[model samples]
Target: MMTNAIIPLVYGLLIGKSNDDYNQFFEKLFEQDNFQPESIMTDYEGGTIKSVKEMLPNVLHKAVWRQVQSKGLATKYREDESFRLKVKKLIALAFLPVDDITTAFDLIVDEFDEEADDLLEYFGKTWIGEPKRRGTGRKKPPSDHKL
Candidate 1:
């Protein structure tokens, strides 16, 4: 479901999960002519991401934290309970303000050893994106894509 509110509005449901299915959904959605969305939240589906970028240029897109957490647990889990706790904190960075996210992430990375570096790098580049620049000029509003 594509949601603009806490209770997401159902966009479309398809029998098959494919790029064409997503494209069809978006095509029907845009047919309304007044369905401009400021931002969109999705799980880590490559096809969905591609479709959203192709169909809704300039829309802000973010990976849902629940999906990211499960992915991290599957890929980066360790026997140490403390390490698991740290990874949980890093995963929770999705809730942080754009300005504070990068610094908080770096601190967590520093606390962990090289074992989690790949996970951290993936989170940094794919989810948090580059740190937002602090300056006075017409700063671009931060989003998942452009930091």
Candidate 2:
């Protein structure tokens, strides 16, 4: 297997991780030229997402992943083999073609136990915005391709 190292072309420090700060930083980075990136991968950070949407509207911006520990699922992920594998299956949904993702997500979630509901809810709300209250499709559905 091959691995890629992520190196930043531009780097800097910002006082805060708020939308304003990220907005300003992105603005500065792109203001000078019509530089458009093909896509951007960012951890699930609200401010960063907002900034990217505002600053680089045409570029594809994806929320890659949220921290498993932060979601209080680390223990399950560490010790419960079945739970861990299910979580990984959730993550693998990211690689599916955009049009097929909703269906694939439904199939994956059908296998999860009730204990994984919270994690599933978080993922559904964050990445797959549908199957919401009014639409009523059911629950809906991240990750490195090679993981």
Candidate 3:
């Protein structure tokens, strides 16, 4: 899909939503040299993000703000007004310098403690790609099953 200042410029409806589907969409788009865009805003779809990075490595990728907020509503903190507000702040961290986003994110997570533990884990794993580890801070032992 392509847009110009919020107006849809072009788009394609695909039967499947997969990395390959997105790849095909973007690959075809690249055929037009003028299709290169400055930035792209989209929902946090893993396949779309991966395809976008692979196809338009130079273009900035951003999450759609409203969609991001809606995700927070589905998380564990849904009922807490304060938590919701904090999440909005957390999402706004994208506006900060890249180097500062992680520290600020951690601070917000720490403030909620157990209440936001699940949400924190989701954010860390999905967005930050934080490595999973044991509570002791040690890496898990390798699986015993043979390949």
Best-performing candidate as measured by lDDT: 2
Report the poorest 10 consecutive residues by lDDT, candidate 3.
138-147
lDDT of 3 by residue, 60-114 (tens): 3344233444455445344677766766666555456655666677777777756
For model 2, residues 66-145, the per-residue Cα lDDT tens digits are 44566677787769888777776665665576677677878888998787777787777666654757755644333322
- In candidate 3, the residue pairs with backbone N, CA or C atoms under 3 Å apart (3 or more residues apart, or in different chains) clash, namely none
Clashes of each: 0, 0, 0
Candidate number with the higher TM-score (2 or 3): 2
The Cα local distance difference test for each model comes to 0.63, 0.66, 0.60
Each model's TM-score, in the order given?
A: 0.39, 0.47, 0.40
Error of 3 at 18 (Å): 1.3
**By descending lDDT, how would the candidates be arranged?**
2, 1, 3
How should the candidates be ordered by TM-score, best one leading?
Answer: 2, 3, 1
Better of 1 and 2 by lDDT: 2
Q: In model 1, which runs have C-alpha deviations exceeding 4 angstroms? A: 1-78, 130-147
* Candidate 2 weakest ten by summed lDDT: 138-147
